[model samples]
Target: MYKSNAFCRKILCGVAFAATVFSTPTFAANDYPNKPIRILVGASAGGGTDILARALAEKFSQALKQTVVVENRPGASQTIAADNTARANPDGYTLLAATNTNQAIAPHILKLSYDPLKDINAVGLIAKVPHVLVVGKNSPYKSVQDVVNAMKADPGKLTYGSSGIGSTQHIAGEAFNLATGAKATHVPYKGSSQAHADIISGEVSMMFDTTSSAMSQIRGGTLRPLAVLSPERSPELPDVPTLAESGIKGADMYTWYGLFVTGGTDPKIVELLNKTLNDALATPDIQQRLKSLGGEITPMSAADLAKLNKEEFERFGKLAKEANLQAQ
Candidate 1:
């Protein structure tokens, strides 16, 4: 009888331990973000991603009632920050301020220390900024066709600039040449600013850049906008036509910024984050602030963003192959 009683108590103790272990997740959920959160960036400070992160951090901190900090981890083609975010704990704190290059293209271009898609769980898209085909204000190429004519005439002699060898700007310029039958030699710089400088100084023929980066130059008449690499016209540069209207319907390319946590983050937590992000973007203030920066909010679920990231990465593969881009 004593043995039976002791066994019963043991079983109860086992049950109690199991319940506590299972309830741990609830404890996590209840006390999520107990401390300040870190939103890591894979770029230099004051860059587009950094700016957007600061803005989001301001509003997100209010929403979550916790201090959110922005940390920039530049260089190695953003591998440093990407790896950091991928390796962070899956609790609701650390996040990657992801972009197309880091999340989609980097895996294909060069080897990375961590698996971007598998190691990181997408939170949501932040903003989408289209690249504009900009030339020096005094250039003779008045339109996309004119630029194509010049490129076809000069072939590799007509050089264009890009942010880097494996950048979206590089891919877009290459793809544009492929689709439009323009054969310009690609001249890559360490960053868009360098390329834009050369273009403004007429050292390079042309370049495609994000509206935000090129906005000041465009408005200041230093860089003339020929076409925007989007399916539609940019509200910031409404006068410019989509690269499609210039006869290349698919020349449209964009720079997208997003949020992510380490993969295998609890599904409920991921969903909660997704909903919070979408709700944040839906806010009139956020939308207006983003739009003013020549971008639009692109709210999406974690799964949807992941699917979109994969599809876009794969699609860029086809475009990259078609463009005959040499692997770097």
Candidate 2:
């Protein structure tokens, strides 16, 4: 009788332990974000991602009633920050500032240690910024067709600058070539700063640069906006025409930024975060801040963001194959 009692006690203890372990997440979610949160960006300080991250951190701090920090882990095309976030505990504290380049294109250009789609869960989408095809203020190419005609006139004679060899700017340049049936040489720089410098000096012909990075120059009348590489016109540059409006199809591209947490995060915690983020995005102050920086607010639910992430992953595969981009 004692032996049977001992066995029953052991079974009860095992069940209790399992229940405690399974219920811990629920408990954590109930008191979600009691501590400070950190949002990691995969770029150096002062870059577009970092800038946006700081803005978001401020809003998140205000909304969550806890301190929020923006941490930069720039390297390997944003895989470093992503890997760090992926390895972090699936709690509500650590977050990743994910961009389409890191979440979508990097997987094709670089062999990542983690599966971006599987290792990170989408919390919400923040904004989308289109790349503008800009030339020096004095350039003779007044329109996208002018550049296309010039490229067809002398294939590979026109040179374009980008942030790097495998950057989204490079991808945009190549997509432009494929779409226009024109060949243009690619001149890559370490970052957009140097590329923009050269383009302004007429050392390079053009660059498909983000509206945020090119906003100052555009406003100063230093860069001529020929067309934006998005399906829709950017409100920041409402006067500029889209590639489609310019009669150039199939070169559509835009940079999107979103929020992410480690995969397997508690659903309740995720829901709380999504609510906080969507609320922050809806604030008039946040809206104005993002708009001033050339970002178009594209607030989306977590489920919708996840759906878009999957679609972008597949679309990038096609772009990689079409552009002959190989994994380095």
Candidate 3:
């Protein structure tokens, strides 16, 4: 009788432990997002990144039944905001709205406090906006070939403006130089607005600005887009040609945005976040807004985003070396 009681007790304890272990994840997922969630943007308010974040926050709030907020931390090539997110508690309450500048380019050119791949896990990709080669309306250069010829004629005379050092714009400019074998000076500005200002005033020769950022100027006839630095032509500007078509190869670039949470976050939470994000992207309102911003939405799973993050990191490392980009 004593042996029988002991065996029964052991079986009950084992069953209880197994149940607890199996049910924990479900509880965590169901109880998740009971509090407000905040997404950190590495750019200032009203910028493309911030705008995207805000738009998603509204959708996230609606889907999750929780208040979602966007916080701007805009500096250090977006590393500041990235680091903050990396250091936040892995509770799914904090997220980073990251761009290629911080995820791929800045890390190659700056000494960061956090490891982009290890310290933060990518939740999913949001959208990508291609860069367009633009010059002031009054500029003499009218085409990609014209810019290439002028740069070849005066190796260091032609100048291209970028948002900042190690920015996608800067790397795009360098990539153009590498592909075309033409040298042009780089003028780094504090932000794209400043770069646009200089380009409009003819202080800078040209700029590889994102279509979203330069759309207003392009439509206002203050800026003339020469070609898109993308694999294909932009739907927003169907008339514009791609750099490849214009004889410039190996210079395709885009400013891609994605969501990331601190490393070691619960996989269930990450899965939920990815699902929520994809749902938001699928909405008609989101699709229309992103389309208006010259963005392309391609929903990707968490694993897919992780793979892309790794590939972009490796690709940028090689490109930076070939372009002789140095950490500042």
Best by TM-score: 2
lDDT of 2 by residue, 236-320 (tens): 8889999999998988877888999999999898898899889888999888878976788887988999999999988887878
Q: Measured by TM-score, how close is model 3 to the native structure?
A: 0.86
lDDT of 1: 0.80
Instruction: Report lDDT (CA) for all predictions.
Output: 0.80, 0.85, 0.89
Error in Å for residue 224 of model 1? 1.8
Top-down lDDT ranking:
3, 2, 1
Total residue pair clashes for candidate 1? 0
Model 2 C-alpha RMSD vs. true structure (Å) is 2.6
lDDT of predicted model 2: 0.85
Candidate 1: residue pairs that collide: none
TM-score of each: 0.84, 0.88, 0.86
Off by over 4 Å in 1: 1-25, 138-140, 189-191
Better of 1 and 2 by lDDT: 2
Candidate 3 regions exceeding 4 Å error are 1-29
Cα error of candidate 3 at position 171, Å: 1.4
Which number leads on lDDT?
3
Worst ten-residue run, lDDT, model 1?
Answer: 319-328
RMSD of each: 3.2, 2.6, 4.0
For model 2, the stretches where C-alpha displacement exceeds 4 angstroms are 136-142, 149-157, 163-167, 187-194, 201-204, 245-247
